[model samples]
Target: MSTPVLVINSGSSSLKYQVVDADDGGALAVGLVERIGGSGHGRLTHTVDGEKHRSDVAVPDHAAAMAAMADAFEQHGPDLAAAGLVAVGHRVVQGGARFGHSVRVDEAALEIIEELSALAPLHNPANAAGIRVAMDTFPDLPHVAVFDTAFHLTMPEVAHTYAIDRQVAADHRIRRYGFHGTSHAYVSRQAAELLGKPLEETNVIVLHLGNGASACAVRAGVSVDTSMGLTPLEGLVMGTRSGDIDPAVVFHLARTAGMDIDAIDDLLNKRSGVLGLSGSQDMRDLVDAVEAGDADAQLALEVYCYRVRKYVGSYLAVLGRVDAIVFTAGIGENADEVRELSLRGLESLGIEVDGEANRARSKEPRDIATAASRVRVLVIPTNEELEIARDAVRVTGS
Candidate 1:
């Protein structure tokens, strides 16, 4: 019997799961359980026989959502009756300062993962709850915990360290813990593959821009620098969160404006960013507004692209000689305007994009670099779920 692994990525209200043939590292079935606690309704989409099965059901909790998913797979995919299920790979949000790599799940592991919840209050507890329920549902299957912070563990002291006082930092574990490890790792390797160069020999900058945006510097296939620091709230502006901000703004809003800490946090984390600047976070909306002569939208876009360009320039300096500059994720993959605008006028650094090629993205990786430029530019969609699944296979002893 061929060994199979299950990849489970649980969000606050979503569960992304897939069955993969570990031998070939190929996905067999993929689906998601969304709107766990909301009225949007729960649905499952599974691939089989070249067609997909989708259905709606009530999922008040992650456990129920996960159970429905297993039922869907058993009723839809390869046999689970006598099937010996291997390990389940869970996408754990915060492994904290303790774990630097994927580890086999155990009681102690779960406790430690829970302990780190204070650090990632929004993500870790929810992620841990999903893990616990999965363990209960599949008691016989070994599970692996893959962390988002594991890959960025390579960052040096100087880069990860904040400029704040040492005693406070040591007390609070306040240091840069870069997220999007799986995507950053995979995208960098793809960049190397596209260049037909050794993974350990080249440098590249990967812009991952989904709802939460970030920049990464891949030097010789390992992450050397990244924009996200201490939390996902840092770095480039995102869909709903203000990225970079003045440290004093928080205190000023509280003292002078009578805003409290919680209110300020909610405002920045939930109501700010492109949404705050232009009343919208979707790039499409911003672009349309700009075309229709909306000054605020145009300025929001300008600020977004300008920050990306600045990071590209800085990472280029950090790398010294980058082989390629890559873009991935939702906005990075589909927003040609953002890509083109960000890479524009970079000819002085040998980082020019071919205007025609930039606008002609299609299936498979293609170089969009200008014929005269030295660095190759590319648009590659990220699949962090696949990476998490692969890591799960390795850790579960499959």
Candidate 2:
């Protein structure tokens, strides 16, 4: 049996994990622990060897969640000891500019991740908690931190630097630190492989359009640019995030509308985007509503797709010669209507979608672009866990 790496993606109130064989990228087990410290009951579900096991309990914190996860492995099968676990790879959302790559967990590294909590208020704290709990649970096993921002560390300073005062920006570390780099890196490599081109020779524009969305421009296997800036809220319009809004709106709300900074922040981060526009954030629901002639839903879909299209155009210009435009994540890979709407007017840019291909449903990566199109358009499912496991293996030398 091969040693499998444990990959943990911790959120503010949930933890998702997978045990993956670093040799072949196969999942030995996959599970999720949700609603930790939330209002309702918490649940832990684990699946191994095609068998599913679930438990509903009060998971008060991440420590309890980690305990439940260890118990799940103990009860289900493939005991951690028998599986020859070599390392635990944690997904740290915001590494800032400090951690350019995955590093072995140490007190110093942990401190750096904690210091970065200010950059990712909703994510880094939870990630740090998961790391701490996992370290305690498997004190002997090597723990590695695979950062989401690590892949984007190759981005040029010109692309990452914001147009602001240099001293203030440096003092506060205020500059673009894109999120979703793990997904973008994985999908871009897959895209190149699908095109039968060397990764170093490929230039791709990847859109990860889940509830939290981002766009990345990868040129020759390096991140040249990305959408999210400073935080995850500055990219594509997400479920509740108002992406790419004018900065003056914050001050206007504070001065003119008598709203405080926190109120304005809450408004943009939690009460805006597609939900603010259509009253629902789920694309499936929005699509259904569009079919039923709901005007708000129709407008929301248009705005969402239009924003994606604009980014595609901007990234194409940035890349100069793009080989493919790849889409991943929930809405990107699954929503045919959104994909169609997004690439509608891109024909002149050597991008043309095959209507039938775009409408076809499949989990596998495949091209949806017409054969005559100069640039290929593909839907590649992202595998961030596999990427994390691979990085863990590399860093741990296991």
User: Cα RMSD for candidate 1?
Assistant: 2.0
Candidate 1's C-alpha runs over 4 A off are: 1-3, 22-25, 38-52, 78-85
User: Model 2 segments beyond 4 Å from truth?
Assistant: none
Give one digit per residue, the lDDT tens place, for model 2 in 1-398.
Answer: 57599999888889999999988889999999999998778998899999989889678899988988888989997788888888999999999999989999999999999999988888899999999999999999999999989889898999999999999999999988898988998999999999999999999999999999999999998999999999888978899999999999998899999999889989999999999999998999999999999999999999999999999999999999999999999999999998999989989999999999999999999999999999999999988999999899899899
Q: Using Cα atoms with residue i matched to residue i, what is each candidate's TM-score against the true structure?
A: 0.94, 0.97
How well does candidate 2 score on lDDT at residue 167? 100
Instruction: Give the per-residue Cα lDDT of candidate 1 at 175.
Output: 93
Q: Name the best candidate (by lDDT).
A: 2
